[model samples]
Target: MVNTPRLPLLFLDIDGPLIPFGATPQQLPHGYPAYRSRHARPAAEANPLVTRINPAHGPRLMALPCELVWATTWMSDANECVSPWLGLPELPVVDWPETSESSDEDDRSGLHWKTRGLVDRAAGRPFAWVDDEITEADRRWVAAHHSGPALLHRVDARLGLTDGDFDVLGEWLRQRLEAPSSKGVSPASP
Candidate 1:
C-alpha cells in the first residue's frame, strides 16, 4: 500500500479571519453581514458575534488540502464556541507561551506576537497562516526560521476571508502539494 504524505498545516485565526470587525462605514455601510447557523447550540446564542461567522467557511476551509489548527486567543473557546457555530469538529489549538519583557522587542520590530509560536508549532512542516496581523517582518522571520515552504497570508480584518484571499491560499497550497517534497524533510518533522 502506498503511504500518502500528510497534508500541510493551516494555522487559522478566529477574530480577523472568521469574525470580522473594524470596518469603516464606506467598507460596510450596514456593518458586517451576520450569518446564522442551524448547528449552533443554545449557549452560543448569548454571544451575538458568533452569528457573524459565516457557516459556509467551515466547508470552504475543509476543502483546502491542509490540516486546520486553531491559532487564536480564543484558544479552546474556538472548539467550544466557534466550531459548533461553523459546523467544524474539534481542531487542535495552538498553546501560546506567555509574553516576556524581552519579547516586547518583537512587537516593536513589526513581528507579530504569534509569528514565532506559529513557526515553532509548524516545526518546519509546510504551513499557511491566516490572520489580519501578519506583516513582512513575520514573513521574513518564518522564511528564515522554517525549513519548509510557508505562506503567511494576511487577511483583511474588516473583510474577513474573501474569495480573493481563498484563491491565493488555495492556489499556494495546491502548488505546494503537487510539488515534490524537500529532501530529508518529513512532513512529520518538527
Candidate 2:
C-alpha cells in the first residue's frame, strides 16, 4: 500500500460530532444540568444537528496535532455560539461561496460549500474532515477533489471526541508521519 502523509488540517463539525443530540437531563457537579435540553438539536434550525463542543472536552481536542477548524453548516453562527462556550478568544472565521436562491433545507450541497472553504484554506495541504454527515459519496468526492493525505473520521454524537477517537486519530497521524515522503509532499510538521 502506498503510504500517505500526515494531515495538517482538522475539520471539526459542531453539532452531532461535537455535541450530543437530544441529550437527556443529567445533573452536573456544579448542581446545574451539564447538558439538559440546552444541548439538543433544534429541528427548525438552519443546521439543526449543530451545537457547541462541551467545555470539559475542549482542551483535549485542542491538544491534537492538526490545526482545528470549525466546519459546520451554522457558518458564522458556529463562530458566535462556540467561541464563548469553548472559552476561546475567537473562533476561526471561514468563507463560503455566494448562496443561490435555490438553496433550501433539502439541499445537502451547502455542507460541501463549507468543505470547499476547507479545501481552499488548506492550500494543498492534507486534511482530515470530522463531521456527522460525511458519507461514502462525500468520501469519494474528497478523495477525487482534494490533494494529499485526506481522511474522513466520523464521530459519535453522544461521545464527541472520546479517548478512543483521540487514540485512533493519534495512531493514524503517527503512522502517516512515519511514512517516507514521496511525490514531494512533505508530511505535516505538526
Candidate 3:
C-alpha cells in the first residue's frame, strides 16, 4: 500500500463563519442584498447562507492554528468582496485539480474539492475547516469524524469565533507543532 501524507490546513469561510449574522457596519458585497433577497424572506432563520459577516474579526484569522486559506462560495471572488473589507491581501485561490470536470454551471459544492486540494498540497496532512453551512453530514464524512490530527471547526455564525476558540485551536496546533507525531487529544468543542 502507498503511504498517503497529511497536511494541516485552515479553511476560512467568509459569510457565516468569519462574519456574524446581522452584524452592523457591514460592507455590502456587490449585488448582495438583492441577490439574497430573491431567496428567503427577510429575517428568515433557515437561510444560513445569507447571513452577515463581521469585518472586525478578520484580523484575528491571521493567528489561527494552521495555514489560513479562504473557503467560501465566493471562491476567488473573495479577492474583491472580502479582501478590501478586511484590510488584508486577497486570499489565495484553492483550485480544483486539473483533471476535474468543468462546466458553466454554478454548482458551488467546492468545499470538498478544495479540501482535497489542501490535503494533497500538504501531502495527505490534516486540516481544520471553518464554514457556516457545514452540516452534520460534512463533519461525519471528513476523515471518519474522529477529530484526529486534522480538525474541523464549525463555528457559530452569529457570535463569530471568540478568544476561547483561538485558545483551543492554538493548543492543538502547538501540541502537533511541538511533537511531530504525538497523539495528543484535543479538547472537545464547547
Candidate 4:
C-alpha cells in the first residue's frame, strides 16, 4: 500500500483574515465592499458582514500549496455561511478548548488564546497561521514550541487578505513545500 503523507497545514482565521472589520471612514470611504459569488446562497440567508468576504480569495487560497484548516471562533458557521462566499469547500475546524484561568493569564501576557492549540494541531508538521490577532508574542511562542518550520502571517483586520499577504504566504509555504521536510515528508507528494 502506498502511504500518502499529508500536506503542511494552513490554519486560517475567518474574522479578521477573511472578513475584515474596523476600517476607518477614510479607509473605506464607502461602507465595506460586497463580493458576489455564484456559488453562494442568497443574500437574505447571510449576515451582512459575511458579504464583505472577497470571493476572489477562494481561488487564491486554493492555489496555495498547503492544507487549509479553519481556526476561528465562527467554527462550523464559517463552513455554512462564509465558505460559499469564498467558493471554498468545507475545511477541518479547530475545536477550541474551554477558556480557563490559565487562558486569562495568557491573554494578560499578550498571548493569543489560539496559539497553543494551533501548535498542538500542527503536531510537528510544517504549518502557517494566518490571523489578524497574531502578535510577536504568538510568533515567539510558536518559534519556541513548534518543531517544524512555521509562518505566523498576520493579516491586517482593516484589509483582510491582500496581494501582499498572499505573496508572503505563497513564498513561505512554497519554500516549505520544495524543501525536504524534517518529518521525512517528500516534497514531491501530490
Best by TM-score: 1
- Tens digits of per-residue lDDT, candidate 1, 136-189, equal 778777767888888888888886887787888898788778973642221211
Q: Which residue pairs collide, candidate 4?
A: none
Q: Which structure is stronger by TM-score: 2 or 4?
A: 4
Cα lDDT computed for each candidate against the true fold: 0.78, 0.57, 0.54, 0.78
lDDT of 4: 0.78
All candidates: CA RMSD (Å): 5.3, 8.1, 10.0, 5.6
Give the per-residue lDDT of model 2 (tens digit) for 21-89.
654434121322445245534421534333334555566666667667777766677666665455554
**Where in model 1 is the C-alpha error above 4 Å?**
22-46, 180-190
* Candidate 3: segments with Cα more than 4 A from true spot: 1-7, 23-52, 96-122, 145-148, 182-190
TM-score to true structure, per model = 0.84, 0.64, 0.59, 0.83
Off by over 4 Å in 2: 1-7, 24-52, 99-113, 180-190
Better of 1 and 2 by lDDT: 1
What count of clashes does model 2 give? 2
Q: Considering TM-score, which of the candidate structures 1 and 4 is the better prediction for this target? A: 1
Better of 1 and 3 by lDDT: 1
